[model samples]
Target chain A: MTQTPVTDSAVNPQVAAAPVAVDVPMMRLHVKILRFNPETDKKAHWVTYDMEAQPGDRMVDVLNEIKWYKETGLAFRRSCQHGICGSDAMLINGRNRLACKTLVRDVAKDGGTVTVEPIRGLKVEKDLLVDMEPFFDAYRAIMPYFIHPTPFPAKEQYQSEANAEKMAHSSNCILCACCTTSCPIFWVNGSYIGPAALVQAHRFIFDTRDEAKQQRLGVVNQNTGVWRCRTAYNCTEACPRGIPITQLIEEVKREVMFGQS
Target chain B: MYKGREGQWAFLLHRISGLAILVYLLLHVFSIGSMIFGEPFYMKIHNTYDFVLFRLGLVAVVAAVVYHAFNGLRIILMDFTSIGVSVQRQAWYGVLGITALATLYALIKLIPRIAGGY
Candidate 1:
């Protein structure tokens, strides 16, 4: 057998140790979620879940993973998986945001936990889904659908460039209800027409094709309508679509006050 | 007139009465500034106070001012901290109760003075 010479340095007791080959497992995310079931329970509870999330994983992905692999009873509302759907809005770390657009890595960047709760100012139906009937009711009460004058063909209504530009900004409402849910006025007075409905009313009031501007203005002129807004600008901040809700509401108030529309 | 929603009704009433009080304040300031002209102008305007309608107008202005002041304080408190939002309904009721009592006291005192019996 051939003898292999071992170096004295390799066998030395005081030699600097080679870098520790410790296999550190990737960090896991601890999501503290609020859960409620009014049909069966009297109070809400917090449920925790450990999710292994990658750098680019979104909140929707983590939720879907939990729903599919961990707990079949977990429930949430999601659609389109894009920012346009506005269905996945929930409170992430005490702020309302669309779950489909929030990156998990950014939220859990410091290797800390994240908390998810249902949007405030609405009745919670399940884990993360809120009953949006009140929100949509306010939207419909404002007459969101277009109402143009009669005696016109089925073709597109002719609108000048200036007219189109006037109504363009208010036309970006996606009916997300995020702004409505985030508004303090709506939380206090459910009868208040809210920012979403007021913005919708402004949309029609500014549109050149709409001939019922006066009637719409009359509808919003009631005590619970545009007057209820205190211009706190919370709705504008909570809007994920970046719609200028406060500006539109202010313009509508100006028009109503001056009787210009 | 709104029955079921007392809090909302109170808010609307507060705003309406606040605006009324503001308008009345502006008019009162303008009328009082007429004193700069001399006692003749002051007496001319002050003599109108002896009439019944003018007395009633004084009462209305007083009531509106009292209610608006109390409600404005409540709103200011609401803006100062989140504590007011949590107890907003209670705070509103407190303002309403205080305003009603103050208005009643003022009316009692004013009616006697107007009748020249105080």
Candidate 2:
């Protein structure tokens, strides 16, 4: 390697100097995103962007690149960007994953076309964004908050450590629509309470302190509730928190079927 | 939901296979009802099943049944068992691989019987 001495002009580029030799090859990726804007467009369409990215760059960073440097019209949601907020969940390379959690190199195909789209079963709000009202409606139907007949104790309510551990996986949910949106049953039958809501139901139903176990079981006893789950395991696979969503849904289904008291 | 190709394919195969089995069961019971009429009527109805086209249909149905059964086991493992939940993608591949080989073996055996050896 030949050394070109750094001139005073190179140190302070206002003076200008000879261009430095370059060797690193630029890596590029094509992010194919589904775009829709009800205000201006009749239907959704595919839009591709050519982006230069590093191996470690996250999918949200790729969208940020398009918004910040390439195209300003790109739209998606992000909060903590650390998978905690679960706002950036989307379909990347044919699976639901957090945009901030998915790395650029991981999703890039061997031939190099990475498809990005809003999670299914929801109305598209815009590019890479989906209306989350339907998902939240199912979640809210599950009565995610704790419910008990008796009033609170003078101090903290007595919940055993063993009992808390039973609801550990269900408690990890951050309201990400990945599991629910990845469900085929939910896509065909929008009325079906999907896996995410079922998991939420399980969260409360299994809590020893909860007095509404019977109520939660009744909520999921219908045809379009936990019975709709065919155990495809797509929800289990799509969950970012590694929660056993299918297992939780199955527990609810068993409770519904056998009338567990 | 259908975005993931492998999972979507498995789910579709499961549903289609299930419907196929149910419809076949109805047809099977109805056709066997010919036995109540007499021996000739029963043999006449059963003879069509010996044809090449029906043999091919048999192979397809068997494939469907095998795929559905194995995939159901895979899903049961995923849903009921604690450990298999995490490696579901790999379990999916296992279901597919086993179904393919088992279906092939079934076809190979059925092709021989189609020629009237059995």
Q: What overall lDDT, based on C-alpha atoms, would model 1 receive against the true structure?
A: 0.74
Candidate 2 local Cα displacement, residue B70, angstroms: 4.9
Cα deviation of A261 in candidate 1 (Å)? 6.7
Judged by whole-model lDDT over C-alpha atoms, candidate 2 comes out at 0.81
What is candidate 1's CA lDDT for residue B75? 62
How far residue B40's Cα lies from its native spot in candidate 1, in Å, is 39
- Separate DockQ for every predicted complex: 0.04, 0.33
Report how far residue A46 has shifted in candidate 2, in Å.
1.6
Model 1 lDDT at residue A30: 87
For all candidates in order, the CA lDDT equals: 0.74, 0.81
Which ranges in model 2 have alpha carbons more than 4 Å from their true place?
A: A1-26, A109-111, A257-259, B1-10, B29-51, B69-105, B112-118
Q: What would the per-residue lDDT of candidate 2 be over residues A89-177, giving only the tens digit for each residue?
A: 99998899999999877888433878888899888878878889989999988888878678877898788989999899999999889
Query: Best lDDT goes to which candidate?
Result: 2
**Clashing pairs in model 1, backbone N/Cα/C closer than 3 A:** none
lDDT (10s digit) by residue, model 1, range A167-258: 78778877778778777678779889898899899999998888788888888888989888764556766788888776677677767777
Clashes per candidate, residues 3 or more apart or on different chains: 0, 0
